[model samples]
Target chain A: MHNASTASTTEAATVPETTSSVDSYFADHPTPPFLDNYKDRIQDLLDFHASSPRPIVLITSGGTTVPLETQTVRFIDNFSAGTRGATSAEHFIAQGYVVIFLHRRFSLLPYSRHYSHSTHCFLDFMRPSEDGKNIQVVDEYRPEMLQVLTRYREAQSKRRLLLLDFVTVSEYLHCLRASALLLAPLGPRVMYYLAAAVSDFFIPTKEMAQHKIQSGDGSLSLTMTQVPKFLSILVHSWATSSYIVSFKLETDPKMLLPKAQQALARYGHQVVVANLLHTRKERVVLISPVASTEYTSNPQYSSHTIDLAPGTEEIEEPLVEELVHRHEDWQSTSSS
Target chain B: MHNASTASTTEAATVPETTSSVDSYFADHPTPPFLDNYKDRIQDLLDFHASSPRPIVLITSGGTTVPLETQTVRFIDNFSAGTRGATSAEHFIAQGYVVIFLHRRFSLLPYSRHYSHSTHCFLDFMRPSEDGKNIQVVDEYRPEMLQVLTRYREAQSKRRLLLLDFVTVSEYLHCLRASALLLAPLGPRVMYYLAAAVSDFFIPTKEMAQHKIQSGDGSLSLTMTQVPKFLSILVHSWATSSYIVSFKLETDPKMLLPKAQQALARYGHQVVVANLLHTRKERVVLISPVASTEYTSNPQYSSHTIDLAPGTEEIEEPLVEELVHRHEDWQSTSSS
Candidate 1:
């Protein structure tokens, strides 16, 4: 499935390097305050898992926002609920992997995803005693609730899962960079599952309005420059040994495979999990680089499709399982 | 309190009529499908409360998004967690008022606001028995949780609170218009508490991209037309006899009062609750029209400040009380 022309075309689209250099982008944007606090927390987490045989997975989830003003009244936001990342994190945890969840503030998390953002309140799950002295989960939900609660408690007690949060794209980049650099020492034991829907464009702070954009001005015109492509730098420079997986979400079905292949070729990442927006939960195509042999002519890359019956199965279960297997292969090959 | 000059200046900025007329805006934008379903629900709700003495208040909460494309991948979003609207809904319920909570989808709700969207998950507040047979709220949070549970249960049992949600500005406007028209029969007994942070600008459907906007085209420039000022029409036509209250939120402290006053003058709405972004949770100014008797000129309109000693009080409590008092006065005056 390696379409060279399409891949090269998409490379230009995905990596609009004319906007700003990677180094300048980092230098120009101020590091978020939370990075300093997360440094201590992430270090503590890594230290706790230092001697454990379990692989450590960093799952970045949700959507990053681009502020339009200095004192932001409004922002440009990507559309995502973090379902893929949250669901996948739970699978990784179940498979005996230590998890570091870096998510958008108030977006879904692994254990809490089931109840938090639903139309029905969490209180709806509770049933009061006849005497009104005690409360318990309703009969219908108790089984699943108890299971989730037990696993959550186990993870918390063992400190196998660490949580971090970000609001804006700047914060997300800073945190991601800091985390990747920290996780670099872990080498083959680390996996970077980047599922966050990072913004493609952003209004530079200097170009943004100091106050709210007033409506009296005939029409409001916003000029936003393309955000620097950090995936290339992340793969080549930061945590180069870690097995990295990035998602390519496309609304147009025709563009999905090509864009995924292009992202794989351009970024030189280990895997590109490609899915169409409408059927993302039901099916996904995992595209990765395939090694070439001297005697035979083989495809430069391979694509494997994972399909789940809608409503009957969670695709993340199979997706994570496949990735874990591939990660193991990657680890063994890298070590040799 | 009502500075005429400032009010006029704000009127020009607030209602940018140069973009489109109210009639044209409605004609151009397609109606949201939920409006038809909500019409029946609203009628049923009104029928249920036909004989009740409790006042009915429609509270619009949270922020609306402006989609960038027809099949939206990205959107411009306002900054709001629905704190004011959710907090005020609880107060209105406590004050013997029938509540209709119209809010942003997945934003905070009244009782759920306390636990949902917190840094800690709701599971953290629960404890499972040693044998893992039973689960209950932890000792520290039981009191408040029990109180909130009781009130929520009562509201559910009585059908005193109704919930409706919208994500985009188009959906919000369509729903708001339909609800206002349906509630007009209630006359002076009805109140409109509009606390939602709506987008001032929107890229019209005709102008929006059909698919996701590509980033390869150097810098992206967005030209957005002003959203029509519907408040004026809502007050004068849709729900003429209802006591209308709108919010004016500004990042600039100096622009806050003037904009609030201008909104009041331009819309001829009953009240304008003005607050600055940083100090909003602690203090707000309520501005309203004063009767001009032939005898004396009482400054045209009056402004009353509501301040909560931070961390000690919920501003919504006193703010709701003051609004309730003013609503009672409005009803009496209208009838007389």
Candidate 2:
């Protein structure tokens, strides 16, 4: 299954003219073979997009990590049990999209199996803890997630697919890198939402001694280093890249705009979300920088995207609408 | 603890303005404690009225079933997960109201425990199948829920209090009658959102055997009968002596307004919300008659209160602003 890890894109790929100018951006994107057995996944997504006069979006969730050390890695951890990320995924699906949820272990996302762009089956690992045991867990696998993936599995029955599990930051990075390469052939319309709480820094941990640290905390004092940024990895790793968006949380409100603009400038991302630890439940602000194009046939790039003021209210809708529309326009222009 | 169950009014004893107006209407009410917890209740309620700068609304949630055979019986159960009720409670709390949430068992509310007004902790019950020995159960007796109810419990600490758990509907009704009496002295500002789906029709299964019914070729009879309606009970019960609001869910949109008006007319309630179930959500239209009057040198009833068409986009802020303005008018009248 990993043999076609980085499949070559067709030199003369057909662009369907009947599809809207926005959809043409995702011209290279594979629709992941349609099958009759899966009841929920494809039909809902196709019907919603074909019916509604709005652009659809997919938001990937869970925790992404970076490797900083060889002996032991420095990880950026959050208190999030995946409630906010999971809720956002639900809202996006409700808004109608072929949601490609690259969720982490124990995400507890609703209808995960029948909710992906690619109907791929993956295994998630879990170790028992007291708090973990107490959470309102649905022990049984969700029907929708299981059913769709199994259908896809039979279609590609010839090759055996691999299922890998991770414990440390290095392992997560390796998995993400491998997955990104496989998804590189996807068209530009793919809007990448980096909502995961990725550790910005990591430290080298000894592979043999790493298992020992799980049982007991060693006198592990070490140096830390910044890992390759996800947004950078996202853009540079692919040729026909998706619209990347990253989050920036800071203490100062005034610094939010500059930091967001910096992220956009540094990574060439479409949107940057900034939030304080205090506003975790309530208010959040997102700044979307739409780059204006001159002498372009596509009239959309004629205007620039504006950064809306921050409020606790549902800003996600307006933000997505503006960003996706821009993405659609940008895709058509770049492809043409 | 059951003694706390009584009427929440002192109008019968008080020789206030319009004793005759209500006296002529309700002749046969549930016995004295007719206005349960009336004296101290009324005083504390008056304090809340004087202090609160906004509309004070109390929203009740969950189901209430009528008994058929044994005094503690439930006939039919509707698929109510308490979404509407719990969501409504959060909206009320958001609007800055001094909210008093009368919730039932197993509600999926978010800020219920965090909110100051959430009622006492109710036990959630689950029974295993015939083959299974152990049962699975989860209850929300969070430290926060206990903290909110500590004051109420302390006041009645000197006296004996018994906590009753209800699985069948009749026990729920019995518990509510007493609970409403404790909340009765709250007066006109009280806005009860009766979102619970009390069984309309029930089979005579209250006294059925605990053992599972085996499949048989023999004739099985289900004598279905109209269970006592909670709506009618509220309209007729002494609980409606204070300002009350009821909900009406109908299949037909055309029937909504007429039924809502009928509910307002029958119950003498301030508001009757008529909703059409479009999928899992309700599209509501309110019918509020018998508006409350602010005390003045010449006490005059204000027929105009905040009435607006419900919009799916956003209504939280608008509702708060409208309710607050109306409350200010009430305060102005009271001060003068």
Candidate 3:
């Protein structure tokens, strides 16, 4: 298998740095048109829990697209099913946390994830009643449907979850910044779970074609600019006192730990959940920084791997429990 | 609006001709690995309809992807909802034509299309019964669900529909050829409805990166070759005796009729259904070649526009009726 860390580090030296600073990137790109409409809803959600003790989490899911044209008949897309974020949100909701799910427009969501994109059409679970005037769930599928329905209805009635959507990398970045600034007031009680597979390169709006790219040319060549990394800005500027968790996905097993540790040291974030592409659903390693000793000035690193339990179908349950403990610990110490 | 026909025409003159022949394109690209399995199913369907007078139609829907890497972390995609093909397939089935639905995986499908991928999640349609032990569709939605369920069950029991899927342009082309040749023996009794939004450019497998493309470099440039046009080959070589209908989608109102007429002249195909991108669901113009007189030397062109009726919802119903009539006319005259 290819070693992802080696490839990335080796390439970094030979390439001239063209990564834009976050400030310049925002100045160059326009904010999404719908951001204004979302602001009021976001403010209302934040205000609803302002005086309560419930921890608010912003979970970003799915993959962002890099459009090659302004009109976008064609674009480059990253591979992601958005399972990690969706599953994690469900676990958090069950544990009494308010979730703000910012995801790709049509990617999976928490409760509905069980049925929407499954192998069998949702209708397959239904049958006409004896009179043929009503529809009822098949006997074999009734229990599961009722359980999921109950939870979905409870979530809806409680109004504990907020759903937001984006499609392009530009919109994602703008939404992230706006959200981080809005959540900054929550301090240690807020968590930013950045699980979205964001694109690392994009074609600037000014440089893109107004119409669809024509294919009559013998060979079509596209030059895309490097997307700026914003973890540092989020840590030091946007949400300095809030807990932050990011993900690192690599195909090489050997690169998982080191790359994750490197991210913790570089970004000064609280946690990095690392996993290999093929084995992601079964296991993940959480890497974080800890104090070495009571008197020591330097911090030590800790890595813990969580595996799917013998009887469980998903690893997200255990993963979320672990994070909640760490978040609680952070809150107690920070407040003290 | 920008004229699509003019843009394509003016670009063709300035660019070097690099379009490949059908034989070479197929020779260069390997067929999908699963083709062997589908061949048996294709044969079974063909055998079942051999003695019956029922007409068989192959409807290709959805958009094809162009992968940039062999492992496929990134790919260029064409935008399509696959509504036209899915809606038309339902109408064809209702009109007594056996359907072979060749669609992109996860795109819309007949019967299931009404529920999946809609604004409300499929779960929104269901609720717990009075005892809370069973699930039932909401009273308001039960009637529509029962109607769709009836048609779906009928189609399933009759074995009149076969679903096949593809993702990449390469796979689509290979599948198209295999299907056309397999259906060739049916002669004029078959119809090929090509509504897929196929990519015009693709990176050859041999030339693509073995792993995910690195974004550490300052600027990434990708060069893609033009995909060989396969309509002429489909008309003349693959299924010469089959009735064929293709679609032309354009943004310019002025180009809708002329470009469609030009396609009929160039490809020697039976019909081209043309529509503007914004108003495609509301209206379409069917352009076909007709014998002008009993002693005419050349075929004359006929253009008929179909608009959504005041009370009706879908344009596909009327569109399919028109094509069925045309297919019947062609069959009667050719056999005579």
Candidate 4:
């Protein structure tokens, strides 16, 4: 396996020096339209954190798009459904941490994630009351709805969860940098959970088409540059002392662990959760500098999976619990 | 603007002759995994239609993804949210037609479209009862929910709507051809609404990477060939007598009408709905062989927009009504 650091360095040397720095990247790309509102929302979260002693965790979820044109009729996209990040946020909230969920717009969200993305139509969950004048949750779904509702209401009432969203890679990166810098003062009390499927390559703004590319020219050929490695910047400068957990998703099982280990060695982050495309929901491996452990939904390892009612499985429940325990241990050791 | 027909012909000549035929393209590409299930679904829909004199309209929605690799960690996508197709399906059912909705998985659905893809959380529409034992739709949204619920229940109980979905461009095209051939016997009684934003170019299966393309290779360069044009075959062979309505969405307003008209002349389809990327929800022009007419959401043309209470607007309401009228006219004229 290639060392990620060496690979990135070699690639960077070939590209213009101006494109290597994060600052230069932002200077070249147009600022996202909602930057002001994003900053204001971050401020609101910080204010809420100031009034409480709870640790704040920022969870970035979903896939980011790299537009092929300025007008963006076509783009490159990843295959993320945002299931891992959104599910993890709810678990973090349950562990009494304040969550700032920065997700892809219209992907998924905490609490609502249970039903919104299901194949069963939302209308199927509702039934008319006996008189047909009112609509109510079906009896079978009421208990689950109530559980999610109570948690959601508790979080809302306490102002513990702040939801923010982005659509494209540029918007995501800008918001990530701004949020990290804004929360820098919190030091170890802040945690960064980067689960988003960020684009590895992008067409630079200077070379992208001004409008939609017409197919009348016969074949379409595109050359995209590697996106600057931002994880190193996030760990070393943006939120230097924060607990950072990043994800490595791969289709090839053999590449999973090696790539994840390379990410840890390269960026010096706290944790790297590795998963395969086909078996992700059923299995995952958590790799840290000190240890590597596997979690699975197999019946034999029921304890490693969520302890829901028999026949019901949710791997995220156990995954989040494990992370929370690790984060707590890290907090105590570092403070001492 | 270049004529679409001439451009397609010119492009076709440059490519190997085998690449221009639909049959050859399918032979080169792997059949989508869901082909069997897709055929079964179409059979069910055909059985449903056999018993009813009601005309059937097949609505294809959302964007089809063109995969960059056979394993597919990443893909190229278009900017369609499937709102147009979902909204039109509901309107078609209201017009007393049996509807077949072939959509991108998790994009949107007819009744569920009202809430599923919205920025507002689904939980936002629910409130705990005074007793805290049950949940009900909030009073503010009850009237709307009731209206949608009634219609949804009516469609379900009457078995008037069948929902099928696809994700990749290959699956979409395969399903489309299968559904069209199955419905060919219905002739003018069937309508084909092709609204899915299909990729114009795709990397041939033979050339696509079997594993994720490593970014360590530095800049990524790709060459994609123009997708074979299937509309002409759909018009001439697949479902020749069906009322075919295709969509032309361009970011450039200047090219909209001419491209749409060219499509009509080349494929001999009945209608081509021309829309600009930015104003598609608010305005669209219906271009037929003889004339082109615009439809807008402006209250002055309320009859052309869904007549909700004074402030609310939905362009699909009027758009579907106009199409239903046109279909009815064509039905009568052809039957005579």
Clashing pairs in 4: none
Candidate 2 per-residue C-alpha lDDT over B1-336 given as tens digits, one digit per residue, 9 for 90 to 100: 001012113121112224342332233122234234433443455464565544455455555433322322112234344566655555555555555444444343423323312221111212222344322222343333333334323322322111122334444454455555555554444445566655444334443432222112222233444444444444345354344556666544566666666544433444565565552252345555433321112212222223334665333334434444544554454345
* Candidate that would win on lDDT: 1
Ranking by lDDT: 1, 3, 4, 2
Candidate 3 off by > 4 Å: A1-24, A290-301, B1-29, B253-258, B290-300
Give the Å error, residue A179, model 2: 28
Q: Which 10 consecutive residues of model 2 chain A have the lowest summed lDDT?
A: A1-10
Q: How many clashing pairs in candidate 4?
A: 0
What order do candidates take by DockQ, descending? Answer: 1, 4, 3, 2
**Model 2 vs. true fold: TM:** 0.34
Q: Give candidate 2 misplaced runs (Cα > 4 Å).
A: A1-336, B1-56, B63-75, B112-167, B203-210, B218-220, B232-237, B279-282, B290-336
TM per candidate comes to 0.93, 0.34, 0.89, 0.89
Alpha-carbon lDDT, every model: 0.83, 0.40, 0.81, 0.79
For model 1, give the RMSD to the true fold: 4.4
Give the C-alpha miss distance for residue B74 in model 4, angstroms.
0.6
Q: Model 3: per-residue lDDT, tens digit, B1-336?
A: 011122223322122223456666777778899998878898998787778899999999998988888867678887776899999999999999999999987778889899876767777888888898888788898888899998887887787889898988989999999998899888788999999999988887678997667666778988888887677667656777888899988765776687777676656667899987789999988987664421133446788999999999999999999999999988887687
* Stretches of model 1 off by over 4 angstroms after superposition: A1-20, A293-299, B1-20, B293-299
For residues A1-336, what per-residue lDDT tens digits would candidate 4 score against the true structure?
111222234322122223356777888877778888888988887886797778889999999999999998899998888998888899899899999999998888899998877878889988888898999888899999988988888888888888888888889999999899899888778888899999999998899998889988879999999888888877766777778889888888888777877676566667887888888887877776542221111101011222334564777777788888878877776577
